[model samples]
Target chain A: MSRIVLRNLVKSYPGGDRRATDEISLEVADGEFVVLVGPSGCGKTTLLRMVAGLETPDSGSVHIGDTDVTSLSARDRRVSMVFQSYAIFPHMKVRQNIGFGLMMRKVPRPEIDRRVADAAAMLDLSDYLDRFPSQLSGGQRQRVAVARAIVVDAGVLLMDEPLSNLDALLRLQFRAELKRIVHQIGTTTLYVTHDQAEAMSLGDRVAVMRDGRVAQIGGPLEVYDSPADRFVGSFLGAPPMNFFPALVSDGPALSVGALSIPAPSSLARFAGRTVLVGVRAEKLAVSTDAADGFLPATVEVVEPTGASVLLTVRLGDHELKVQAPPTFDTRPEASVWLRADPSTMRFYDPETSLALTV
Target chain B: MRRFALQVFCVAISLFMAAPIYLITLAAFSSRESLNEFPLPLVPTDPSTETLSGFLSSTGVIAGGVNSLMVGLNTVVLALLIGLPAGYAVARYAFRGRQPYQLFLLLTRALPIVVLSVPLARIFLTTGLYDTTYAVTLLHTALALPTTVLITAAVFVAVSPEQEEAAQIFGASPVQAFVRIVMPQALPGIAAAAVFTFVMSWNEVLGAAILTLNQRTLPAQVLSTLSFSPLAYRFAGGFALVVPALLFIAIMRKYLLNMWGTTLK
Candidate 1:
């Protein structure tokens, strides 16, 4: 029944001119999983630390369930944290590490042992209960960290880039495992990571932070499909959404160089002004046929990533990336036709960078 | 061929280092008559317990041994008690003048012990603590504290702060986090620091000699009385002085290994 609420949390380091976390406010429902994702130094980690009571906000309050835990120490806050480095006690065996929280609370030895065993079994670590952290592989150590956090049964769990240290294959495998485990435990989790893919896959809701403030927060598909601004649109997707400076004509047609394409009717009000037309790489369809509406371009680079082929194309002075199906064959230096779907195209005001909605 | 040459060179250096200790051991166990015969014996011709037994029985030697042991143990306890927390503070927390404080500790070491010893002796006399093991231990702790702080700080720094934070998040208070997570990880280095402090106190002569009269440490007693003692007694006294230092290292060898080997992951 733990619901987390942050109210205008602002934290700034002494030496830095910029605030580490600036006026961030959000609410997480009971047993909700929310991920804060951004580039490094974007304060996602800072925001999560504030919630865990590891970092104090200069001005604001943090509430967990019904308690205002802003002034409480991390121990009194009743939260469990998983660090990026795992932070497993190297001197202790897996069993002792998992039971450390319960031990700290003066739980009975038998009960501690039972809970440790339960957590170890859940993480598939029962066989290695006697082993030290140094003896385990990277993935196993991460699981041990998770087991340690969950064994405490704290309502709120904070994870800071937990999968960042693992190799790619292991990261993918553990990403699923972590999501499944958190879901099963039903803890209100606030996870911070710089990886957008991890955010999308693991979080029930994704919060995109930039420069110490949350730029956008919504469901993953909602964010990906309708990003709030240019930064959110550009930061969330792979290869990023392409932005082109275009002028909206009387017919609300976007004119890029000598190429013209019909803009969505919603953009008609913004006619006769320069706007940034945003299109996802996957939204741009590449075809060999030079149809009436298709813009002709030369393929500059062809990259095949097993399932999809990414093509870097030159349209006049602009280079646009397009993601096509793996079967689409186009060698570098070949001429191709690019078609933009008007419905998927987003319009942004160049000055404010905010998306323009009808 | 290069590797073989390097190995031979290393062995040669080791033997050179061990030569003095070997000579002392030889003379310590040699009969008094054998030691008196010129051209000091390369090896003990007649190895006997006579010289060691005689040295041990001499006036003040046994008492001095007890005083030295007391001083060394007390010095280590005092130095670590003060130094460990200071070291952890410097390592983990950021404060104004921290760098200057560390530098000041180093600066205290650069000053000759004789400079401090005279004033310290005067104060000890005034305080009615003169000629006691306590006076020697206090001076030795002052000498060892700088090293203790630096070593323990380095050790604590090697233990990741994230681990302590993780511990706190798991319901441990700050002190509990330090005791449970950081302290165990830092034990090896702290043990190494303790050994160093013990050896420093054991081998210290000038401060011990200046600070005490009747309750003189082994080194102070040996140095003060060495001029009149026989060569056999001198060698035996020197050998006796070396024993505790060697034993301290031996006991802490596992921690020393840990300091050099495995990094805390």
Candidate 2:
């Protein structure tokens, strides 16, 4: 029943040129998992630390379950965190690490043991409870950190790049386990990471941050399908969105070097002004044979990426990426044709870099 | 060739360090008649306790031993009490003058102990602590603090601040987190500092001789009297001084070894 609400949070580090987190406000519904994803120094981690009471904002009010806890220290707040390095005490065995929060809370001995045993079983660490962190593998250590965080019954759980230290295969495997465990515990969470795939897979909703401000916040598929800005579109997907510089001509069509795209009515007012046309790499179709309305491109590189093939092609003077079936046979420097559905195209203002209304 | 050369170098260094202690022990325990023989045997051939027993039975030896042990142990405790916090602060915080403060600590040792001894003795004399073990203990603590602060600061820096933040977020107060998490991890460093302090205090003769007369510690007492004693008795005193430092290091070796295994995977 604990929901987190932040109001107008602004923070700046000493000697930093600009604010680390600008005037930003956000809310996470009860039991919701929200992830903050951005490039380095985008203020996503700073925003999460503010909520966790680890970093105090220059100006903000934090509310947990309707309680204004802006002045409370981290120990007084009902929050738990899993650090990037795990931060497990090397001297403490697994059981002690899991039970540390409970012990600090003055929970009874019997209850602490019961909860620790349950958490151990949940994390599949029962057999390793007596072993120290030095004896555990990286994945096991990460699981121990998760177990320690969840055993506290905190109102909110904060994590900062917790899975970024693991290997790729472990990260993929642990991603599902983490989402499932968080849902089962029903604790509100605010996770921060630079990895887009982790943000998409683990969060119920992703908040895309840029320059200390949230560029967009929406469901995973919603943000992926329609990004709010050029930055958001390019940041969220693999291969990113390929942008082509164009001009808005009559009929609100985009006029590039040799092609005219019929844009939506939103571009009608800027009919004579310049704009950028953005399309996802996966949205452009590749054809080996020539067809009408398909622009010819020179295949510069063919990358077979397990499930699909990504081809970098040169159309006119611009290079673009197109997704094709993995089995699609192709060779370097070969000629190919490409096309895209008009609805899949997004138009952006070049100056502001914001997505134009569609 | 390199491996063999390295092993030879290591053995050479070990023998260079161990030879003096072995020689003193042999000289201390040998019979008075046997010690008179020229080109003394490198090995223990005539083991006896005549000179050692005579030195032990001499006046004020046991009392000086007791005073030395008190001063050494007290120096270890006081130095750590004052130094550990300064170490943690220097490691964790970045307040103004931090770099200057560390430099200042190093500079304190740059002044020779002899120059500071007169002013230090005058201060103690004015405070009516001239002839007490407390004066020696205070002097030893001041001498030991720079090394203690630098070493423990390095250890605290190696200990992750994230662990302390995690503890605070988990419901422990700042003090409690330091006690439960930081202190245990800092033990090996503290032990190393203690070993250094104890040995320095135990062997320091100039300050102890100037500070105390009738209440002199073993080293100061030995220095005041050993020039007039026989050579065997001097060897006996050397044997006695070396044994305690060796024992203290032995007791602390466990924690010193714990330093390498302190990190999480």
Candidate 3:
């Protein structure tokens, strides 16, 4: 296993204007599963492909350990990739597909068999060894793709949204299984996906990307708890973090519409300045009685999601969503009060979308 | 109800096509004693192999069939040799003048093969390759190339690039990836394209007749000897040509649906 480093990697199409991969840099430690996550066209996949050497960087260099691999071809780099469509050769049996790299290297038949069997066993694909890809289910085909990569014995593995094609249940199951398999092998992996859940679950560290650049790179929770900017914070969670246009009013409070929430005291120096206040739904509380820095509001909608209820409340023209116990039933026009756990409230400059010092 | 009507329409069309061939076979098989009979019989009173044998005995006719097979196989091999890599390059790579190269191929198809045969023959004679099998096969490429390139392009297109990319990532070079992954996936279509190439070469006459004299392909032989040729010999030669058409479709029946579907697009 070796660390992979990308430095100022840039890729622009021939005679084309936009940069597909901008001057971005990242590092994946030995045995680390680093996932690059973003929306489509954010250049996460392009960056991964460049590292695998399927794509050449217009400039900049990629290093595996201390070796510069910028000019290396994909085959020379010894980086295995599991593609989105599970590109198993249709004519080859599962075993042959898994053993292709070994065959190419002229590995002896018995060794190829042993490695194929080992990979098949690891991926639970041994029983389907003789079957073709067409005979396999989507999940099974994915396992075959994984087996093919693992059998190559390459130190680095790149996967581009490999689970995106599977159904929800299969994706979740394979997400767990993939982590277990990759962890056992300890190959350095660079995974790319647009799904935040997959990124959070699979990556030892996740790189959140936006507009062809790394917005932030940290342990999943670190990026989630303290995103570098508004985009990272907004992109890292489900139902997403809520942002309110507000002004940092006097007396440790930020006002949004007719509602005001207590701001941390450290932010008092920025009083009377326009700011953005963000809070995850889980951190906002709803109650019947108003408290200090809490606002009374009318509930507009209550959505029950089996385990929790999401209450959409109207506070003047601004709306806030609060996650509460499913049993905490409320109806439209019902009166409620909203409070932000001050410690969890994220503050940003409204104009620049940059996080505030506090 | 509408589907049944469509099925009937299709059967009607099939019979419409088969009817003439059926009448021709009947006429060709009828004995020489019945030659002047009018309102031709639907079936001959006695079918005999004599006509086919006599047709084979005709001057240079049988040899022409052998030449046709040689020329057709040669065309298939050469076209695939040149067109396969050209198709792959055009489909997978982007370089300067790639679109122009494609436009040039299309332009070749637009200019009639007949117009170029005279010029090509002169060049072949200069090269001292005239009247040889190589000359005939090379000339066929002019007719075979456009279809070969286009057909192989479609074949390569249907094969997803991700598969080849996956192979490269798994420590296989581009050539290895194409051979191990892309080519296998594209095989069925490639086979169909090869058949199309063979058919084009086999049926081509105007160019072959003008280009070669002593070494003539089936169509050239048929045309050269059509005047004063026995009726049985003409029909037998026609029958032999139709044999390849039948074999072509039969051999590719499984892939025909896909081939036709792609070609129509």
Identify the candidate with maximal DockQ: 2
Compared with the true structure, what per-residue lDDT tens digits does model 1 show for residues A152-242? 9998999999999999999999889888999999999999999989999988999999999999999998888888899998899898888
Tell me what TM-score chain B of candidate 1 gets against the true chain B: 0.91
Best by TM-score: 1
What are the Cα lDDT values of the candidates? 0.90, 0.89, 0.86
**Candidate 3 at A346: error in angstroms?**
1.0
| Residue range with the least summed lDDT across 10 consecutive positions in model 2 chain A | A254-263
Candidate 2 chain B: worst-modelled 10 consecutive residues by lDDT: B256-265
Question: Of models 1 and 2, which has the larger lDDT?
Answer: 1
Model 1 TM-score on a 0 to 1 scale: 0.96
Taking chain A of candidate 1, what TM-score results? 0.98
Compared with the true structure, what per-residue lDDT tens digits does model 3 show for residues A192-311?
999999999999999999888998999999888877789988898876777887888889787877667777898899988888888888888878776877778889998888889988
Instruction: List fnat, each candidate.
Output: 0.90, 0.93, 0.81
Per-residue lDDT of B12 in model 3: 100
Q: What is the DockQ of candidate 2?
A: 0.86
- Evaluated at residue A83, the lDDT of candidate 3 is 93
In model 2, the Cα lDDT at residue A291 comes to: 83
Better of 2 and 3 by lDDT: 2
Q: Report the C-alpha lDDT of model 2 over A1-358, residue by residue, as the tens digit.
A: 5999999999999878999999889999999999999999999999988887889989978999989988899999899999999999998999999999999999999999999999989889999999999999999999999999999999999999999999999999999999999999999999999999999998899999999999999999989888898899999989988887788888877676777656677778988988878888989988899886577889999999999999999977788899998888889999998887878888888888888886
Q: What is the DockQ of each candidate?
A: 0.83, 0.86, 0.76
Ranking by lDDT: 1, 2, 3
- Candidate 2 contains a number of clashing pairs equal to 0
Better of 1 and 3 by lDDT: 1
